[model samples]
Target: MSELIGRLIQPRQPAFWFMVVLNALSMVLAWLAQKPELTLTVSLLIAAFALGNAALGAFFAWQLIRRPAK
Candidate 1:
């Protein structure tokens, strides 16, 4: 486990913008799935995932923007 951890490195490119766009899209899809014909359980699950992804995206974006690029 220590060896594996030591080998891991943060990517130089933050890719925060990409994540933000993807998560935003996911949230939109999840919202759309809440139509009358959709299953309530499935819609809720999707919404939850969407919310999580969006939060992660926002966090990454904030971190990326906070630092000055080398």
Candidate 2:
């Protein structure tokens, strides 16, 4: 619904988007490396990074929502 979409698009701390960009760049570099081992390592690292970021973002949003209105 619109509520979910709004939450997703709402701006938050800058670190979230920075990590996303970093992960994307990492993926591109991995694809272009042309080495099987390096690509595999980078892919795994990027996946871990993405999952961690998601968890962090969820925690931050939950905290924000739970804060009492001032």
Candidate 3:
């Protein structure tokens, strides 16, 4: 478990930072999804945030895939 955690953070680069943001955003989205009484405005905001993250995540993913293997 510790090995996995260490490997996850060892890079200290843009991908790592984006990963951290993505994780936090996912948790927030999950928690929000479980709520039954959210206002429409709040829901819309979350949806927008998610969409923005999706674009950013896709760009980074493309960059990662394009990177030459070690």
Candidate 2 per-residue lDDT, tens place, 1-70, comes to 6554444443464544554565565555545455565666776775666566556656655543444322
**How much RMSD separates candidate 1 from the native structure?**
9.5
CA displacement after TM-score superposition, residue 39 of candidate 2 (Å)? 1.0
The most accurate candidate by lDDT is: 1
- What lDDT is reached at residue 1 by model 2? 62
Reference-based lDDT, residue 28, model 2: 58
Q: Against the correct fold, how does model 3 do in TM-score?
A: 0.60
lDDT of 3 by residue, 12-37 (tens): 45776785577578567756755669
Weakest ten-residue segment in model 3 by summed lDDT: 3-12
Candidate order by decreasing lDDT: 1, 3, 2
Tell me model 2's lDDT, rounded to 2 decimals: 0.54
lDDT of 1 at 47: 79
Give per-residue lDDT, candidate 1, residue 22. Answer: 62
RMSD of each: 9.5, 5.3, 5.0
Candidate 1 vs candidate 2: the TM-score winner is: 1
The runs of at least 3 residues in candidate 1 whose Cα sits more than 4 Å from the true structure, single-residue gaps closed, are: 1-12
Candidate 1: residue 45 Cα off by (Å): 0.4
CA lDDT scores, all candidates in order: 0.64, 0.54, 0.63
